[model samples]
Target chain A: MILVIGGAASGKLDYVKSLGYSDSSISDGFIGEEPVVYNLQALVAKDPEKAPGYYDELVGKEIVICDEVGSGIIPATREMRDAREATGRLCNRLAISADSVIRLVSGIPVKIK
Target chain B: MDFLLTGGAACGKSTYAEKLVLGFPKPRFYVAAMRPYGEESFIRIKRHRKMRAEKGFETIEKQTDVDEIELPPHSTVLLECICNLVDNVMFDDQGNMYDVTDRIISEVLTLKSRAENLIVVTNDVGSEYSDYSAGVKAYVQAIGDINIALAQSFENVYELVCGIPVVLKGELR
Candidate 1:
């Protein structure tokens, strides 16, 4: 499994695509061959409980891309904060078993294993 | 063993640091830098405290003056954040960036000396180009400088990318 992470507009998806995984292989919502779970935070926002199960199924199988959305000023609303924390927790779980983890800073990939 | 953990907000720096400290010997201390300023901060503090509970950690709440705090001999300490300490020291006073950065670096060095192992947590807030006010920009600069100094001094530095620990300086144990 490979995990790709970066902030907004950090070109995480482009970096993953450069690795040879085409658009057809990457799945935005459903799990598939080379599933690219871009914006994992959105899944948490929609259903926090189901998010972890989705991550569990993707371990060692999917290529994940997510924004580092936890930073900046703390959110005012409770729902937003919950979503942020849930996203962070889910990422931690995914990273522990991931074969490789890459961080993209301004479209540059830095390997973090 | 000195460890420096940094990442964007909510990237799981705190959770990873907490896990790292457990690898060392007992008498662990969690040095919390954030104050309960308002509702959001209070919620964060509560969550962090809950996370640390029953983890064999003794929590020490200090905004600044970290060097002045007494630690048990040969104990491991986790500084929950460096940016909050910077804010506490620089928020009221209009000090120059160099002085503030130096102050923080000095304090971190002192703490490092006192503890057998120090796990320092910091946020990467300067990565993005922002239209924030002058004060915020200065704050970001201070954090960036302090991170560099600490990373150079500490044996290990890990940047958490969406909860994934990426080692930039030294290996993680």
Candidate 2:
């Protein structure tokens, strides 16, 4: 699993695609909904026994790309907070399971794991 | 309550949210929705993460589905972008659009109903050109509708232009 971090137009998606994953497989254009949970579940459904082993899947078969979103402030509203919390927790879980982590800046790549 | 920050591409919605997080005294978790789909994007994501890590910011990377995770009530969360989240959900299972949308909305609402504070980032794709492919048009429309609904639910809504935050609804203070 690879945790990719960057702001808008940071080219995170393009980086993942360069690693050789199909556009459909590695794309993250969820228009109006929360996608991390569903994407994780889809990965789990692929292999129930290895569902929790997201890291294992990334070892050789493919690179799991995740967005980094911790550069901002907390929203004053409750719902916004919840979404942030949920997204943070999911990223943390994946990071813990990931073999490597990377951060992007102005289209630049830096290894952090 | 839900707080929706929507704007055009490169409008600085993510940056504004980041600024907000920096103001909080407590530890804040940044939820990133970006993925490296190609070599160019890969480098970009890596560089950004490096910058945040240097600043001592702890991050979480999630692509889709948020209901199964465990979150801290005391910590504030910033959901970088809803557009990617929606794409992940829609692509997961094309036939399950209704179920996926409903589930996402419910989960988002649930998060707001339980968290101390939440900030959501999304794109205002509706204000741009609308004469793309049919599928693309539908996708844009769906996202537009979702953004509107999110704004309705959120108490604080802002639209960014040239990196400036124009308050659309509710006061931040």
lDDT of each: 0.81, 0.57
Question: What is candidate 2's lDDT per residue for B54-147, written digit by digit as tens?
Answer: 4445687877665544676666677767777777766544454433455566666666665567888887655432357665566676677777
DockQ of each: 0.47, 0.02
Ten-residue stretch with the least lDDT total in model 1 chain B: B90-99
Deviation from native of the Cα of residue A34 in model 1, angstroms: 9.1
Model 2 scores a TM of: 0.55
Residue A37 error for model 2, in Å? 47
Q: Which ten residues in a row have the lowest lDDT in candidate 1 chain A?
A: A29-38
Supply candidate 2's per-residue lDDT for A82: 43
Where does candidate 2 chain A have its weakest 10-residue lDDT segment?
A29-38
lDDT of 1 by residue, B12-95 (tens): 888889999999989999999986777868878998889999999999989998998798898999998997898787876455
Flag regions of model 2 displaced more than 4 Å. A1-113, B92-99
Superposed by TM-score, candidate 2 places the C-alpha of residue B64 at a distance from the truth, in angstroms, of 1.3
Strongest candidate by lDDT: 1
